[model samples]
Target: MKSNRVALAALLGLIALPLVVREPYFQHLMIMVLLWVTIGTGWNLLAGYTGQVSFGAAAFFGVGAYTAGLLSFHLGVSAWWGLALGGVVAVLVGFPFGWIAFPLRGAYFALGSLALGEVMRQLATIWESFTQGMMGVLIMPTFLSKLPYYYIALALAAGSVLVVRLVLGSRLGYYFISIREDQDAAMSIGINTTKYKMISLSLHAFLTGTAGALYMNYMGFIDPHVVFSLHDISIMAILVGIVGGVGTVYGPAVGAFIMVALQEVFRSAGFGALEALSKAIGGGFMAGLTKYVSQAHVLAFGILVVVVIMVLPNGLVGDWRKVSRLFKRAS
Candidate 1:
């Protein structure tokens, strides 16, 4: 009960953030964090809970992005409509793909998902007439201010978390866990493993696709490479799930916040803190250090992942007891 109050307070604080800090750049970062939370939550539903690791989150993301972009480009409809329809389209795509990929197990399923994402990227690039190919799609954004986008993203993230929590409390949730723990055991108990797996995939795809649609509207542009990049979208989703605590309800929320902060720190060279220090120090050494740090964000990310895996294999939330013990020892 005390934890719930603290969580509610934190959420309320986040909801009131834009009113206090009106900076567009910070708001943009918050938006990204919320978006990742949504995607991470969906990915967790399928991979973390159902024991199905997917590398094709980018496929659904790209499909929804294109769905929104295309509607505005061709039909002259509001791209906003895509927010509602995008997830549906993603489900349609995932249904057949899951049917085929469900037969594969473990690493093979992961590979199949990776291949699916690659195929989607290739198709988006090759089909020039329909998708405009690599030229990309551009659209006018509805809102001039970042506040609306931020709030919408926050709501979406909150909704995804709530839906997952409710599902995990139901009978289907147990079935998902059973399959994840031992598919053979789940099947022997009269559970249709394939159907449940497909259901998980569909839910995952829908949430991811909704996020993609949001991205299209927020960013005002879309390209196959940007949306469907394996490392950027797919692997990041996996990292968010793993780093946050895969099977835990609130893990992705915490993971998303940490990963985004880490990404920005390296991407911006410690958010320009290093550059300021370099100027104060007045030396080539400091300048060189800043340059190296800026260029090594990816390396830093890799090291962070490795360190987290080694130190807290189950993630921050999942390993709360270990973390508390470490703090106690330090004190």
Candidate 2:
């Protein structure tokens, strides 16, 4: 009941956010956070709950984007069609791969997944006539305002959390956890380990693909390098899950908000406050200071990665009590 109240309060706050913060920049950031929430949730289901750490999330993500992009390019239909088709296409693409890859197990599976994004990227790049190669595909956006996009992204984020919650509440969730705890034991107990793992993978691919479709529609462009990126897309998904707390239902949402916010802050150099400071100084010191700060943002993020690894293994949501106690102790 306490959680329900807190959740309701949080939902209401989000619903009222756009009304209070009319700045498009802030709204865009919120939208990006929600997008990452969907992505992170998908990764959490497969890697966190199922104990299958995959590095190929970008493979499905890219399929979803291309699904939407191709529909517009060849069919001449509205890219909005991707909202329905992208996830389906992603599932279809992943189904065959899961058949082959699901049997690997452990670190070997992870290593196999590492090639997924690269393979997709190479295909998208080499097949220029179909994917337009590195030239990429662009779609004309349907809306001039960000409001509709924001609500759609909110729906996606909420839907992902809700779906994972439902699954975890069901017998399927038990099967998943059992497999995660001990795959051989689960198999010994008559649980279909491979079947359940595939189910988890499917759910993850579908959610990720749907989010990718959303990205294509919202950004109105798609390219292999951006969509199937290893560092940006795949690694960011892992960081979101880790930062939020792996295996927790709402962890990805919490992590998405923090990771997205931090990225924006560092990328913009404290949202350009440093630029103002540079202007205030107005001399040789300004350019040097700005350049170093801009370059140092990566270092700042690296430090955060280290902190999360060493201190926040349970994540913000899962480790809430520990964090609160530290504050209480300090007070």
Candidate 3:
């Protein structure tokens, strides 16, 4: 009952965010956070619950983006169609890969998924005629205002979480947890671990792919590199899952908000405030410090990740009580 109330409150807060913060730039950031919430939730479902860690999420992500873009490019169909078909295509692609790759365990499985991403990237780039060879797929965005996208993203994030919560509550979720705990033991009990893992992968692919299609509709542009990027897309998903509290529902949502906010802070050089502050203070060392801070975002991010791992290894959700205590002590 408490969980339900919390969920309701959080939803209400998100719904009211845009009304309170009307700045176009901040609205854009919220949209990005919500999008990552979907992607991160998908990643957590597979890796956190099913014990399948994929480094090739970008493969599914890219496939969805391309599916949406191709419809607009070739058939002159609206890109919105991709929201449905893109996920289907990603499942079609992920099904075979999961069937073949699930047999591999641990790091091997991770590498296999990574290889899948590389293959997809190569195909997207090498196939110039169909994909435009890195020129990217561009579509006409449907909405001029960010409001529509914001609400759509909120719906997706909430829907995905609700779906995951349902799945985790059922017998199938039990099977997934069993596989994650011990595949050999699960197989001994006749769990058909492979089958269950495939189902989990399909769910993951579907959610991630849908988010990719959303990206296409919202951004109106996508290339192999942006969608299929191993580091930017794949690794970022992993980081979101890890930092937010792996295996905890709503962990990815928290992590997504934190990470996206951090990225913007780094990318924007403290949202261009530091420079203004330095100018107001009469330059020299302060000017140099501002310049250094902008370039140091990546380094800062790396250090923060390390600290989080060491201090809150279970992630923010898993370690919430510890965090609360620390704050109490400080006060």
Candidate 4:
């Protein structure tokens, strides 16, 4: 346990990077990465560990962002309080989603969550009175400097990691693992699967919602489109989960770093060069992947995701640990 604590502290120190990275653009990217990392970790706790497979994370995320934005714009409330309010609302709403769907297992649960997310998205779009419709509410810029945003994002991401670690180390985590492996078997053994599952969902929603509120404060804008983007819902969180080795404690963080790093690298490599490289390597593979993607970049991301999933089903971190253990055994 002492060794584990030391290792965790060392890993966190490494994450406290970019404090010295002076470029504003890099800082912006770092902040965005951390924001997603935080949200992804929250999502992982429910879907990965608890085996809930939620697609409604975007709903909570959008709710939190809009909640904070609305309060700050109309009522002159501080963001700190707004963040908590958003989290509470998300947890309350999320409870029903889990309660209704918890009886169903596997894909049915996933479909229900996806349906809920879409409903929330549509509500945000139509509810102009509160959400401001397509025009969206803008957060008047206060301190334009990226430093504060960077630190805030970092803190949130760290908080998420710590929360997940705590959960994984506790008795509840063992129950979640049992439930994930076999719900019927776990329930047969006398675990209250329903109560624990709801708890996981509620906590997940709360944390994701809090991160969403932080996002609004950082970006200074909130629109239904930006807040509840389907691409953001289906792709971003899932991709992080897949890349990080879904159920593993350290997987999401590793996945976030790799995903953000790849984006940064591709963006820096010049779009034309990236496209040319993609075409040269896999002709139609990259082209088909990029088409209709809102971001409009080449489909390198999809190909990357596919390769990672196939080559490392347990995810990058999990697979890397296996290799390290194997090497140590051989030595």
Candidate 5:
């Protein structure tokens, strides 16, 4: 009950944030947080709950993005339609891939996912006539204001959380958890492990693809390199799942918020706070620090990942009790 109240309060605060804060930059950050929430939730659903670790989220993301972009470029349809179709297309890709890859387990499955993403990237690059290759794709955005996109992103994030909650509360959720625990046992119990695994993969691909379509519509431009980036998309999704709390319902939400904030802090050189400090201190070492901070975001991410793994292997939310105990010991 206490946790529920806290979550409600946080949601209310976020819903009211735009009314109180008008900075486009801040709004952009929040948008990113929501986007990651969507991606992370989908990743957690498959990898965390179903025990099928995937490193090919970018493939689904890129396919959805390209679906949306191509619709606008070739079909003269609104890119918004891609929001609905993108997930379908991703499921199409995931279905066949899941059929082939689900037979493999553990690290082998992970490697298969990696290969899938690389294949998609190469395909996007080679098919210059169809995909426009490195030239990229662009479309006119529907709204002039950021508010629409913000609300839509919020809806996507919230809806994902709700869906996860509902699904986990259902019978299928138990099957997924069982499979994650031991697929052989699940199969012995007549769970049809393969079917459930495919279902999880399809759901994951759909959610990720939907996010990609949203990205295309909001950002107005995309290239193969940008959309299909393994490190930026696939690895980040894994990080979000691990950092948040792999099997927890709201873990990805908290993880996304933290990760996005960390990203922005580095990307913006502490939101230019370092520059202000440099100016105040006469710009010697602080200025040099500011110059390098933007370039060091990836380094910061790596250090955080190591720290999180060492200190809280189950993740921030999954190991909340342990974390609190540590804090108490320190105090």
Candidate 6:
């Protein structure tokens, strides 16, 4: 509990730093980081908490983006209302997805989610009349500014983290951890595995979808490729969770920071340096190194996921607990 407070304090400090520094570019990066973190927290609730490995977050994200985008474009609705409606639409979709997929366990459930996402992406492509198809929808000039977006994204991220913290500290959270450990056992002990799972997933989809609405408005554009990209869902959801330490409150944030920082570094290196670095590293070095870093940000994210899973099976916060126990023993 004390540790959690400390971690929260650190997060507050990072957010507050921008207020004093006042760099637009850095603020933009910070906005991206917070958005990913918020989405990751939502994913963590579903996969990390409920033990329902859903890879279809991109689908829900796309749904939210489109819902919000269409509403804003056609009805002249404000983003504030669009954000809420996006979440509502996502939950409506999530209920059906969860209802069908929850029957399948483990890999089967994951496969079902991946398929659902693909189907949604195709639909987004085909629905040219409403979605504007591959051309995308753009957010025109509005009363909002970058500072408003920065704070809004921060609030979303903070709200996600807070909800995760609240859940983990409650009885419902215990039910989730039990289900994750052993669904059958959780059921035998009188916990309704299905009920808990659905609740977790619904909350997960809602938060992540809301973040997507914010993302579209922030970018001032939305396209099928960008909104429904499989890569976007995987890196921001799974990879972030894996690297930061899954099922742990602060893990996703740490993973987001590391993954984003690495991307910025490699991106700043430029294409020529990237090619030279690739060649200098050779096949074996490249093969091993690629596990830790990749073109843009995805590969680096993949590597971090692998290393964390291999080295710290329980995740960063979980491992920290072990280390803390060791120190106590030594004392």
Q: Number of the top candidate by lDDT? A: 1
Q: Any runs in candidate 6 off by more than 4 Å, and if so which?
A: 141-144, 270-296, 321-331
Sliding window of 10 residues with minimal summed lDDT for model 6: 287-296
lDDT of 2 by residue, 118-175 (tens): 8998999999999999999999988988899999999999889989889999999999
Which residue pairs clash within candidate 3? none
Local distance difference test scores for all models: 0.93, 0.89, 0.90, 0.80, 0.91, 0.80
lDDT of 4: 0.80
Any runs in candidate 1 off by more than 4 Å, and if so which? 280-285
Rank order by lDDT, top first? 1, 5, 3, 2, 6, 4
- lDDT digits (tens) for residues 1-331 of candidate 3: 9878998999999999999999989999999899889989999988999999989789988998899999999999998899889889988999999988999998888999999989999999999999997899888999999999999899999998998899889998899899999999999999998889999999889988888888899999998899999877898888888889899889999999998998888777788898888899985988888888878866876787899999999899889999999999999
Winner by lDDT between candidate 5 and candidate 3: 5
Better of 5 and 6 by TM-score: 5
Q: Give one digit per residue, the lDDT tens place, for model 6 in 27-113.
A: 878888887888888889889888888888888888888888989888888766778888789888888888888989999988988
Model 6: per-residue Cα lDDT at residue 303: 70
64-166, model 4: which lDDT tens digit per residue?
A: 8888899988898876566778888889878888889999999999889888778888888898887788888887755688887777778778788888889
Candidate 1 per-residue lDDT, tens place, 11-121, comes to 899999999998899999999999999999999999999999999999999999999999999998999999998899999999889999999999999999999999999
TM-score of 4: 0.86
RMSD of each: 1.4, 1.4, 1.6, 4.4, 1.7, 4.7
Backbone clashes for every candidate come to 0, 0, 0, 0, 0, 3
Provide the clash count, candidate 6: 3
Which is the better candidate, 2 or 5, if ranked by lDDT?
A: 5
